[model samples]
Target: MVWAWLRIAVAVVGFSGVVAGFIVNVDRARREGQDLGLVLANYFSLFTIVSTIILIVTFVIAGLWSLRNPGRSPEPRGIALAIAGITGPILLLGIVYNALLRGLPSEIALTDPSGIHSLDVWATESLHVIIPLYLLVDLFFASRRRALSWWSLAVIVAYPLLWLTYTLIRGGLTPDPSGAHDWWYPYPFLDPHGGGGWPSVLIYVAVMLVVLVAIGAGIVAVGRLRSRRAAARTSPVGAAG
Candidate 1:
């Protein structure tokens, strides 16, 4: 019951944060006199937004399941797999933003020099730092998680690959709303025309894919460890020992 409530709380906070960020972005776009449709498109195209949506959906379902099936052990394999799938990209989102992108110029520039800055900070921290940490905690300590097969790493990497492909293609096709550039990219690292060019972009993508797989492997390993401990607690041999 407690765990279920925690999941629900996490979901609520995540939803609120994402909405706040979106609203702030919209306001900033309006203030800057940019195209609202382009702003909306770029906003949802963000990996952070998409990953948070996945996290929110996964937790909402997991929390509700726990509430309805109190005391259940080893949640359905599908749920466990969903959790595994999200763990990698979400953690990567937090890491990449904090390490590389924090304080960088964003598509939605600050609306008034004075106002909405604090709100933006709060929304950014909530989405990038706080929720990701909570999800990490849940991954390590939450109840009802089942061990996933090693092959689940492929499932984990699949979404990111698709997102990368979509982002690159879209970046090439989408016009810059500010008219400052011919094409717009969500992150500088992914921008092929930046100082690094296609080679640098590919290098970054390759490194990121490798790191993502490592994280996914770690999640799967932790799940296996937790599953073993759980089984031990219930096994007669473990009880006897």
Candidate 2:
């Protein structure tokens, strides 16, 4: 009984990741001299196109994986993180990174292009929804508890937040090749200052930070309320035990 809303939320997050990837590539190409009006017509960046196809295939596989005996006991943390890092929207950045490289002109491919958007930025921004979706999935006849715990919620919040902070500190969210060549490459979404200019970079980050903070705060509040309820329920039981 996977919750419908969780499924929808997962789908939306994936869709948004794909959109961000595509937009970043297009923006990268534009900065590289592709005409804005006729970008698709002239742009033959085939690597990413094929990469996108692979992502679609991978996503299908991931969905199938999700449907297989989902109500079992908790998944090993490593496995879920692997799936999140490689299969889900979270991994889209890495995959798209490969695509970007493949899409580049060979002579200048190693030049390390700029980003159209930030992957870390997008994931953190979207996590405001994705984590709750996961919580709801946990609620779908899975957990006996009526709601999620605050600690559980905190772990969930840290997923995207931690990643976002890591990316920014290491120059992840921008398109500049300097950041691209690092071990954590392909973070077009995180590369704000690359071609967008300082004004654009500051503006986007400011707005994104505000929205993400608000969302994180709401999640924390919800978890606190649930924790209080759970504590009240447990007090009498504890005395008996």
Candidate 3:
């Protein structure tokens, strides 16, 4: 019960952090004379915003459901697992990219080009760090167990594929605002004109695909292990023998 409330509290704060960061970004963009469409077009900002919203809604619903039916399982167990599976990789992607490839905000302001507020960094961390950690903890250690299938990993990967496809199509059509290239790729590595060409982009994509697969495998393995342990504890002594 205490853990349930803690999860709810964390979800609310995490959601608020993402929203705050988004507001900062939007406000800064407006001040710089950038349109709302361009601000919203950013993949990181958009993904974090949507994912946090999902966390908020799912956690709140689960918490309330638990309260109403104290001994029963949480409602929408499958959806909760699905949300965790999808957002877990995304959170990792953001953290790894920023920390390793992009450098920290203290080292270099990653949001400088985007004109987002300073506090947006913390907000970004909330999505990529806090919320992801919270979800993993809740999924593994918290009550009201749920089982996830391996096939759902395919479902999780489908989203990023669609996002990449959209990004590529849009980049080809839209001109870069920075005057650096004809196409507008969200990341420099994805830009054919500036990112060394299709070969470079393909290599990066391949590496990312491998990382995504690993993330999926890890989540599934941990989840299945937890499920099996729960099953083992609950089985009758005669059946176990």
Candidate 4:
């Protein structure tokens, strides 16, 4: 009973956080004369939006299934696992890149001339920091391990690749407000005009790919271990019978 209520709480908090962040960011962007499309175009916002929606769906389904069949374990389909697998790694990347590499308080918070408000900072952290951690905890405690597969790693990798392609293509075509030849890339690491240049971008991509693969494998392995333990715990009763 407590576990069930906890899941409900998590879903509510996750939903609130995502919605709050979206409202704050969009309002600020609009104030600065950016359209809704441009505000939503950011990878950070896109990933968080998608991830939170997925999380909400997953939680609701689990809740409904539990209510319909008490004491019976919930078995989520592979699609949910695949979505979780992809979101997990990407959110991790966002958190790490923003917090450590970007020097969170100094770079991500203070350096932005666009004026990062308190609400904006909280929203950013909620998406990148809170959401990722929430997913990790849910995966460990609530998610059914049997639904996950090793091959989902490949499917998960496709997301980041797609994002990279879209970002590069858009950045190349769209001009900055100044009408200069320079285009606006979301992350500085991906921007060629920056001091790091193409080599840096390549290195960042390579590192991110490696990290994604490692994280995907880890999630799969953890799920498998949990499944095995679950099977083992039940095996004794079958043997007795």
Which parts of model 1 are misplaced by more than 4 Å? 105-111
lDDT of 1 by residue, 1-241 (tens): 8888898898888888878878887887787788999988998899988888888899889889999998857789898888888888989888899999998875344335646766677778888999889978988998888899999999899999999999999999998878889899988999988888999999999989989999999999998998899889889999999
Q: Sorted on TM-score, highest at the top, how do the candidates line up?
A: 1, 3, 4, 2
For candidate 1, the TM-score is: 0.95
Q: What is the lDDT of residue 227 in candidate 1?
A: 88
Better of 1 and 3 by TM-score: 1
lDDT of 3 at 122: 73
Estimate candidate 2's alpha-carbon lDDT, on a 0 to 1 scale: 0.42
- Residue lDDT tens for model 3, 1-241: 7666876797788767876776775665665666567656663434456656666776776676666667735336565565555665655556555665455343115435654545676786776777767766766677765667787678667766776787777878875444445667766677787637989888878878778777777777777787787778778963676
Writing each residue's lDDT as its tens digit, candidate 4 over 1-241 gives 4445555666676677666666666765566565566556653435456656666676666655555656646455654565455555546566555755555353324434555466666656665676567667766776443546778777667766776787777877665532345577766677888888888889988987888887777777777788777777779775566
Candidate that scores best on lDDT: 1
Model 1 / residue 191 / CA error / Å: 0.4
Q: Candidate 4 — number of clashing residue pairs?
A: 0
Clashes of each: 0, 14, 0, 0
Off by over 4 Å in 4: 1-8, 35-37, 43-45, 98-116, 176-182, 237-241
Candidate 2, residue 38: Cα displacement in angstroms equals 23
TM-score of each candidate structure, all chains considered together:
0.95, 0.32, 0.78, 0.77
TM match of model 3 to true structure: 0.78
- For the record, the alpha-carbon RMSD of candidate 1 to the native fold, in angstroms, is 1.5
Give lDDT tens digits, candidate 2, residues 102-161: 354432234335533355346334433343345344333332222333344344334444
Q: How displaced is residue 125 in candidate 4, in Å?
A: 1.9
